[model samples]
Target: MRRALNIKNKLSFIDGNISKPTDSFDPLFTPWEYCNDMIIDWIQHSIGFEHRLTIAHADIATNVWTDLRERFSIQNAPRIFQLTKAISSLVQNADSVSVYYNTLKSYWDELEIYEPMPLCTCGSVKTLTDYNHRTKVMQFLMRLLRLYSGSGSSI
Candidate 1:
């Protein structure tokens, strides 16, 4: 998932941002994935946690893309699209979401759905004065997850 998140670090200088220069270093850069079985096990031990929600809930992965696009409206639309596609690829498509795959492939090309939403937080109006965009999107995703999961289960 990190592969497509484009985390876009913003150079924060909070004391803990950078690791202390300790003599007991394990090489400055060895390209770690942070994927440890123990981490997953620990997180699973929580009371309410399930698989990271997949982009394709049921047979309609496009629903997620459309919902995210409409939610962001301007900023983050493209990012959200990419993130959803990544989730779809990682979960539904098993890492491949090309059009050649047909049907579900359309979800992969969601990045081009509307020429990519602006990443810059410019002078764009908020999606709502009653129900903000982010909240709506979260709700939409939750609904889709619930509809497919059929048990209000996480993921």
Candidate 2:
């Protein structure tokens, strides 16, 4: 949702980073208003009925988006704990190696969505990403059963 808004260059409206023109005579005012309307419409159509009713009285897209984020985003400790618990409890069980890995990957993907990697302003994002990648690979290898691990020399 945020990616869609950002692609349309309407994220500023929802983030409160865009300033409204003081006068109706301002040339950018109309375009700004139009963008805001487009964002609000997109948000309304995207959300569920219960969510819509909660933010129905909101005069701007920013408020609606903010409220939705506050409600849905997993920034709380309980959500984090739950995800970590799932990761800790995961096992091969009856599933094949490929299926088990995929199941684990799904949890990691969701966790990534909740805890996104930061875009480094210091031009170290590539280095950071590579490090994160290696860490995840090592973690996955470590979780695999010894019977399937084959030989360490092969690595």
| Whole-model lDDT, model 2 | 0.78
lDDT accuracy of residue 101 in candidate 1: 35
Candidate 1 lDDT (Cα, whole model)?
0.36
lDDT of 2 at 131: 91
The lDDT for every candidate, in the order shown, is: 0.36, 0.78
Candidate 1 minimal-lDDT segment of 10 residues: 29-38
lDDT of 1 by residue, 24-49 (tens): 35563221113222222332343133
RMSD of 1: 17.5
**Residue-wise C-alpha lDDT for candidate 2, range 63-125, written one tens digit per residue:** 778788888775767776787788777776677779877987887888887888997799788
Candidate 1 residue runs with Cα over 4 Å from true position: 1-72, 77-100, 114-155
**TM-score top scorer:** 2
**Residue-level lDDT for 35 in candidate 1:** 22
TM-score of each model, in listed order: 0.17, 0.59
